[model samples]
Target: MYDFTTFVQSIGNFLHGQFSPGVATALEWTLVILIYLALYAILGLVLVYVERRVCAFFQLRLGPNRVGWAGTAQTVADALKLLLKEPVTVNKADKLLFNLAPFIITLAALTVISLVPFAKGLQAFDINIGLLFIVAVSSLGVVGILLAGWSSNNKYALIGAMRSGAQIVSYELSVGLSLLTMVLLTGTLQLSAIIETQANGWWIFKGHVPAVIAFFLYLTASIAEINRGPFDLPEAESELTAGFHTEYSGLKFAFFFLAEFVNMFTVAAIATTVFLGGWMPFHIGDWAGFNAVMDFLPPIFWFFLKVSAVIFLMMWFKWTFPRLRIDQLLKLEWKYLMPLNLMNLVFTAILVYLGWHG
Candidate 1:
């Protein structure tokens, strides 16, 4: 007879013997949470500086140079200022939910980081359903946005929240569809498994035309999902006066701002994992010498390089494009992106069935 409990206990005992159970558990959870928090803080500062520089380049002007070495410390200073500033609650607003919303948004952003594989074997949790876990946790940000908007008791806040809810919901379908194509091709939903499948070649290359199309669809859907420019109808400055966070001041507002930048990197990381081969290095077709050279570089470097390129593309979109109207946004998603994504998934399935992948 199969002793399921004993079998499970044996496995647990094995793991405990290999790694001190109490210490390993504590260290693993701590490292996961700390890495997530540290990445947000560092990336938030870098992105703010990069955005200013990029915007300045486009406008033909010098950007922030007053603070520590070309305004690198500007975000840090801004963070300190926000921390010192007092938070104000509107008279008619739901105080608890209103205050809780920003924290919720921030937490949601951080939670998705756990599933992201920074390098081979570097992921915090190698959950079998890692990809699905990410999608589910990321969607929770919408709830936070809705709560924040509704609790503010401001008309603009309500409008922003409603727009965000609709926009995120529509865009999420395309994102999911794009990911489904990858899952179908790889035959597993685990992030690490997806990367290993791409060891011989990146999915964007291996899966051919369908994968390429899915990549673009994923990019567009991600931009919309993050509520970045073009799809930034929720925070339309001209109309909503800062949108859902209009009534929030000081540290509360800063939390919302930080969440946006973190969300941007989160999307970029997902794109890296799905399409660009996570931390897999470049390889030439059967070229052992070139592949060996590529392997010398750390996995984290490849992961960062891919993610940074995606982030730059996003920043370019933000600075270059004018915001789209809400209705136009929905029309683009439903009429174009959805159909294209579905077709890509079908094509990917055919390729996988035919063993055409590299």
Candidate 2:
């Protein structure tokens, strides 16, 4: 794999050569931290704006066009508004936890961004247990949601949080199984290895039927896990009245909002890396001309294009489908998705064992 982070770090070391080794290392880390922060800010804002525009398009309405050119800065205006607004505290709420929940969730979402390989060499943290770290860190937002609901002293909030917890916990199994399908095929847990294995062809193309099934399963489970509309019981406003973050206001609310938006990107990035081939260009066998055409574009462009495709699919689900009832939601996962996941995992394992995988 190309090492973009190392290149940047080396530049930092060279620039700070007069300083001690420890100081230069610290400076290198600081540069990396700033890059991540910029990514969080830019990507978070872009997702929100794009989602709104997509929803408006689906609804046959003109989206935000007044704030800036086609309302590109609408989310930025909203963020500033949130920043200027005062945070209100609920007297009956658990003060400490209430204040802590937003930051915790936001931090959880931000942490996973470091592990995703955006391009050939543009990864921040490339640990051996990369996939496990993603799964474990991705699940941390649930704790913040649970705490927010509990601290709010609001029945609606509590119910929403519990629903979110149940939903994420159940769907996580399907998501994991879907990912495991690829892991079994590739015989590796490292995300970079997974991507490289698909260099000749994406897993969806290579694994055929079972991989296709797992892809869809991962798609559906990811949407539900993130609590987006159609699976958004956690924030079912008609029922839960704003859900777990109901009592949160101002900057605190902004934090939760940022976490949710960024989480969507995080999920989409995972999908791109796992199924579509992270930073890998489309290559067709024995089609030299076509392969060269595909390779002409930069790797980052290919990566973003794939991520956007997945994100758009997620947005399509959010806008087109009706929110599922809690019972129906649980049933869909357990009775349908879970069964399919188990069968698919077994089938994939069998395929690998028989040496039939392409």
Best candidate (score: TM-score) = 2
TM-scores of the candidates in the order shown: 0.92, 0.96
Clashing pairs in 2: none
Q: Which ten residues in a row have the lowest lDDT in candidate 1?
A: 1-10
Over 160-276, each residue of candidate 2 has an lDDT whose tens digit, in order, gives 999999999999898888888878888888878888899889988998799899989999998898888699999898999899999999999988888898899999999999889
- The digit string of per-residue lDDT tens for model 1 on 9-98 reads 455566667788797566556755786788888888788788888888877898987889888888889889989998989999999999
Give residue 286's lDDT in candidate 2 (0 to 100): 74
TM-score of model 2 vs. true structure? 0.96
